[model samples]
Target: MPAKIVVIANQKGGCGKTTIAMQVGGTLGRAGNRVLIVDADPQGTATRWAASAADESSFPAHVAGLAAAGGKVHREIKKYLDSYDYILVDCPPAVDSPVPQSALLIADVALVPIIPSPADLWAATGTRGLIERAGDINTALQARMVVNMLQSNTSMSKEVLEVLEDFGIPLTLAKLHLRTAYRQAAVFGGTVHDLGREAAKAVQEVEALAHEILSLFKNN
Candidate 1:
């Protein structure tokens, strides 16, 4: 099967892109698929979290690595890509960058994480333009938007839902609600599974995402 490459991206910083990538990768790995995580954030937050998990629980299924930059990044990606079943690239925060461009160029599936705000939607236009410029993407690639860190009971939440609908982006029904467990789980070097309750629910959500991703590979 052709490897499914997904870049968890957003032009804005602090949108939980890294967290989403790591958690999704972790969930997939736990579900028995060989998962490879590329920490493209130069800051290496995802790499650090993977390291913490390895040090604490000795997570056996995850293969997390630091991503290279410049034109060489794509070369490095191509070199070791086939060894895993799935590749999750944690793209940099900036919208304009060679790394994100390279990632989008090769990505079979791109996931943009939106924080459910109008300002965030406005910032997404640049990323959308980048995707638009890369034609024939539907043949070799695809893209979707997922709402993260949602607080569904607020008025802003309703507005955000309307915007996601009007904006014509596919919103994932499962939400990573703004909960203390999300923060606590990350610091402890684990995911919602370790924290329990809503965190576990969050893990289930991501696991469902993993299943959807696996289906994409099957249909291909």
Candidate 2:
């Protein structure tokens, strides 16, 4: 079967797109799936994250850079569809970028990560529109909004959550909280699961996200 392609995109930067792509891809890989992370962002943050891993215990998933492919990314990714069980594309953070639209053309799902802030919410409108447009052509393409760096206690977060209910794209049940372990994982070039006991909560969050994402393809 062809791999389930998940394009992680948001027009605004600093929304944790790479973090979500890597963490979710890594968790799925550890769960015995052949996962591949296509780093479509010119920033190459995903490539660097895998490169930073230690030789003894490298990142669970394979990371490939396809930023140069630009609008041809969907064509490029098609070549690997049969080789892996999952392909997660981390798109560049730009509203004008062709990468997100290209990837979404062949994607099984598009996950838009948004920070729980007024600015982030406002910026996400562009992405929501992009997804909506893509869905018109790619009828099988599903979309979900993932709340990242969520500070549940803050009034801003609460308001953002309420607003997201009508944001067009459905929200994911699993949310990632503001935690130091996520940063540590990036530094160490691994998922939160590698952080051991101190990152228990973080591990659960990523795992839950992976589970929810995988469930979307269960009937396929």
Top-lDDT candidate index: 2
lDDT tens digits by residue: candidate 2, 13-87: 988999999999999999899999999999999999999998634788999899999999999999999999999
TM-score of each: 0.89, 0.98
The whole-model lDDT of each prediction reads 0.72, 0.94
lDDT string for model 1 (1-220, tens) is 5456887777889878887787777777777777777878777887777677737445434545545564456566666577887888888886556777777778877777888888888888777766655535545666677778788888997897787876644666556667777787678777667776756667677677666665656655
Runs of candidate 2 with Cα error greater than 4 angstroms are none
Could you tell me which 10 consecutive residues in candidate 1 have the lowest summed lDDT? 57-66
Backbone atom clashes (below 3 Å) for every candidate? 0, 0
What's the TM for model 2? 0.98
The parts of candidate 1 lying over 4 Å away from their true place are 54-57, 60-66, 135-138
| Positional deviation of residue 93's Cα in model 2 after best superposition, in angstroms | 0.2
